[model samples]
Target: MSSFVTPKKWLTVPLEDVILRIVGGGTPSKSKPEYYQGEIPWMSVKDMNKHVLQDTVDHISQAAVDNSSTNVIPAEIPIIATRMGLGKIVIADFDSAINQDLKALFLPTEVHRDYFVYWYRSVAQKIERMGTGTTVKGIRLEVLKGLEFALPPLAEQRVIADKLDTLLAQVENTKARLEHISQILKRFRQSVLAAAVSGRLTEGWRSGDNPERNFKNLGEAGVEVKTGPFGSALHKSDYVNGGIPVINPMHISEGTIKPSESMTISHQKYTSLEAWHLRKGDVVVGRRGEMGRASVVESDEPQLCGTGSMILRVGEDALPKYLEIILRSPTAVSYFNSDSVGSTMVNLNQKIIKNFEVYFPSLSEQTEIVRRIDQLFAHADRTEQQVNNALAHVNNLTQSILAKAFRGELTEQWRKDNPALISEENSAEALLERIKAERAAAKPVKKTRKKAPS
Candidate 1:
């Protein structure tokens, strides 16, 4: 067991001594259809991950409980999984029954339930070590009963739980704000890309000699877009271990190449589909999934376009980076959204990509627009990094608060202020003895059956 520094006036004892009862639940027979048709919630380990469970994935009839080993657990009791999902704990928010893997601890009046929940979270790692199994690890009942820990007096436990609850709520609020800021950053980036692709971003540069009439369709500017080979032409079985790299929809993301699962095709397969090959300065667009998502090909070596992607070869009039930005922008994305076909999963093809008109200025103006977009994006990136760091710090603060709260550091001043709650009889050791005595007094004596005629 993990060691803890018990504070003055506090005491450590076996877990069972502080609780009224430790009970295990069981499932109704699966073969009996009538047993599972009622309204009682039957919770498995999956339902125990949340702090409070209002309902379960499955419900069983009351007849199921009468015929099976399962017991109905009242609301407010904390339940922990002793089997497969070891250490996960939650409080029952409604009257419920649990499966065999769960153990419910019925707290005595002196112990606070939420405080125990937080305490269990702190020592969950130790409980995990007590479990034994090769395939599905589980904790034996005796080991669970013998686990030891220190806790503050009742009044102090309430105070500590309240403080931690308030502080943790603030941390969660901060995290929610950070996540909202990240979403705003994404929309801002798309807006910048949209403005860059259209002439609106660099409209200030339109002067006496330069006009906005230079916009042209992608195909009119000598750019050709071609989709990869059709479905029947190349099968997944044709892919080999090491050969020419085949870029798929997974490879194109966020205007960059990020291959989800690296794939290659043999030289013979590559030879048949040489028309769909990719080259340096070529723009690759995802044709099957996530329409309009594009990336620039930076490698000089030969690569083939996989079944769900397309390659765009542009002439000297347009830079590959400039067109790549346009393809990823919301302006191009709007076209893809409207033109994409397929009821379930929308798909893109070369015909739709080639005909899309692109507005542009001279090559020099395009370069300036790219530079301006990059500068603004770099600032946003720095802000996003700071937000992420703040989120990490907030999470770390939660753990630190729990550690201090468990060690009596959080309520150290409270203890000094209220000396009466820290007396000898009110300590955890005395509370344990009272619980044991009550349990013994409440036990029923076994009646001996008289022998029959001998």
Candidate 2:
């Protein structure tokens, strides 16, 4: 009742009562191999991810620091990623240089560093409003300082920070536990697939009454497997609005075809590339760069796969789905790896695949094997999906917690206890005005770009 509070509850304080300093940073000459290889630690927005940054892939030296616009961040200063990471913030524990894509805001004595971090993130809506542009978005320095928000007292701020830290830590621990479960699920997937191809999966399906059908070496099974249509004619511009999907290596990950992100061609183009065009159940393998990774066509979409991928339609004796399981198995991977030898880049044509000796059950038994494999895989996939879903939910919750902590709402009880020790503030008007005056009075310091090394 003394100042700024509701019966339900809220607290308010001026913002300028908090800020100590604001500084921008830049990178040293990356062209100078010398600047890049030195002992000093350097960070980029990409490297900025949750909590402590124990190590960096790149470093620069004192000499590079002296030459570059990038400043050496003192300990405990908050480094905010303005782009790339786009909202990631971390406290610098050691001296470091950041690229031009970040901002360093040093907290003042009255404001808790953790509290300021929470507040900056809490006012995300306001930050987003100030952040404008088409190519990339960010708030202007002047505009950010001028930004206003209701704040709790110093004591309340610390409480909010403490609660946030505790809750966020719990979220992180939960995610790590989920990831561990996820890894176990992945291993289960590999084990199931491996067992399927090794003949162990169909052990009971083998009828003593049924005759075993032997698989012809892959080449004899069909013809020599050939590379995909090798023409630069398929330029990016040639891609049509819709037609046949053009599958790339990225589409085939972990030996599975992902049709979601697909490029298309005209039906006319599809006819011309008929030899390379994928069919209903063709087994495709990636060669050239990736070499022997494989997948099977599951989509009804008519399309030509890329040069990085090779397509082979096995004979009628070969079951498409059955072949897909084998090709994805570790045994098939090792077989491909062995045949496509000699160069760092493993290459295999129809000749090598045709020569691969594969074991097959009779048609009736083959169908049974596939059915059993699919049933077990369905169970494994369901478990993997659960872990993935849990990870996503945890990630969203963590971010939301961070968002709330920054806003004074996170510690409403603490604010009530502290009760407007200071008052007459609804927004950060004082902070805004102070920043403007400081910028106006400050003299510009020139920093020159360093020459590249020869």
Candidate 3:
């Protein structure tokens, strides 16, 4: 239903005019278990995800088909959802029985199957908007039939469909490669973190005069661990808008503090709970929910830790950034998962955090480790951003190509080169007449009975 101008020599008509018949399907009785346990492929809205369905999740018996309102659609026929999952169209690879929500469109032989499929896809969003319902939205048959369909010459339809197939397939392959690269970047970052914390990253730097690394409890390594204010100490009523911000577990992500402005306390309330205030160089960690969720307080801003978080103040011997890296490493995450308390929701206390053992290297070595990690992470962030942008463009390319095809822009040159094929007997108008004749010939004739009783 887009306002795209019709191409020259193309025929514009109602969608139903080109189709021979439209058949609605039904589900077999669930009471009969034997009806479901069979070899026949039975389709529903759930099975209509892919463009071509090779098989269905559910199957039904032929007896079920005989007894139910469902009909067996021939292979490669287009089926669309009228009820739930509106705007989806698919073709079955085999003869399949459909449930109540789907309708099979029987197109005339004059129409190219792939061409119709692509055309429907271009207008699918328009169809979805016409759907009406309170709970499950659905389109009426009349609404679907009333929509405009632009038809090109049969030969042109084939050319457009062939072009779309090749172009869309290439787009899909590019997306797959980008997605694979994204996963590789994730693994690369994890590997870097693992190496940094285990002394493997700085091993070569220490080869000349290797300094002894000692294993020590976090409390013994000049780190002060403290839990946030409990629910009794800071009530929900204390929170206010445009006040001192509160850093909860959700606010700590990607090794940085992102406090919520709305989840804050007034200056008066903050003064009373000043003991839980966060200072610059402090590490705020999530003590509940996900394990090893920690971030560094990069600024000396007015912020308070929430009930579900803990704070760690590193002494002169330790670097806060380096400690944050160790906490986010795979080894520390594994330890937190195994030792944390509670069943339904995992929780960590000051005692557990203080007793956690970690490698304690010299201050100079910690500085070097933090610098190297920052450089590597910056590179990963840049690469990830580029990949994300490319992915977004690739996603849009599909609809763009589809729009161009429907607008006749994709096959503009073909139209000029093959003018003879689109004229006279080969025109879309001529094709529609043939389709109409085919429909009239396929209709069954009803016999009249003589009145014998009279």
Residue-pair clashes per prediction, in order, are 0, 6, 0
Against the reference, the lDDT scores of all candidates come to 0.82, 0.68, 0.90
Cα deviation at 286, candidate 1, in Å, is 1.9
Candidate 1 residue-pair clash tally: 0
> Which digits, one per residue and each the tens of the lDDT, describe model 1 over residues 1-454?
4477868767777787777778889989999998888999998987866777778989999999999999889888898999987777898779899889998888777788888888887777777887899999999888888877665788888988898889778877988999999999999999999888878788877665676546677788777888778768888888777678888988777877765334888788888887887888889888876776788999887788878888888788778888888889998888888988888887886677777887866788888888988898899999999988998998787777778888889888988998877777876667666767877765667899999989
Where model 2 places Cα greater than 4 Å from the true spot, the runs are: 1-17, 124-129, 207-216, 220-224, 231-239, 253-262, 291-293, 298-301, 341-344, 403-454
What TM-score, over all chains together, does every model reach?
0.85, 0.80, 0.79
Residue runs of model 1 more than 4 Å from their true location after superposition: 24-42, 45-49, 53-72, 83-85, 125-146, 207-217, 230-233, 238-245, 260-262, 265-273, 301-303, 438-454
Predicted structure with the largest TM-score when compared to the true one: 1
Against the true structure, candidate 2 reaches a TM-score of: 0.80
Q: Quick one: RMSD of model 3?
A: 4.4
lDDT of 2 by residue, 1-454 (tens): 2322322333343443345667788888868888887888787876776556766667988888889898878777888766545556777678777778788876655456787776666655456655767878866666766655444445555677889889988988999999998788777767776776656766666746643445556666553365777767467776776567788766787657775343777788778777787877887777655643577787777768776777777677667777777677777778888877556677766666777776665567668877887787788778878889999999899768865665445665555565554233422344334445654555366899999998
Comparing candidate 1 with candidate 2, which one achieves the higher TM-score? 1
Which segments of candidate 3 are over 4 A away from where they belong?
23-49, 54-75, 82-86, 94-102, 128-138, 209-212, 226-251, 257-280, 288-292, 299-308, 339-355, 417-420, 441-454
* Model 3, span 297-397: residue lDDT tens: 98877999899999998999999998898888887788888889999988998788788888778888889999999999899999999999999999999
lDDT score for residue 121 of model 1: 76
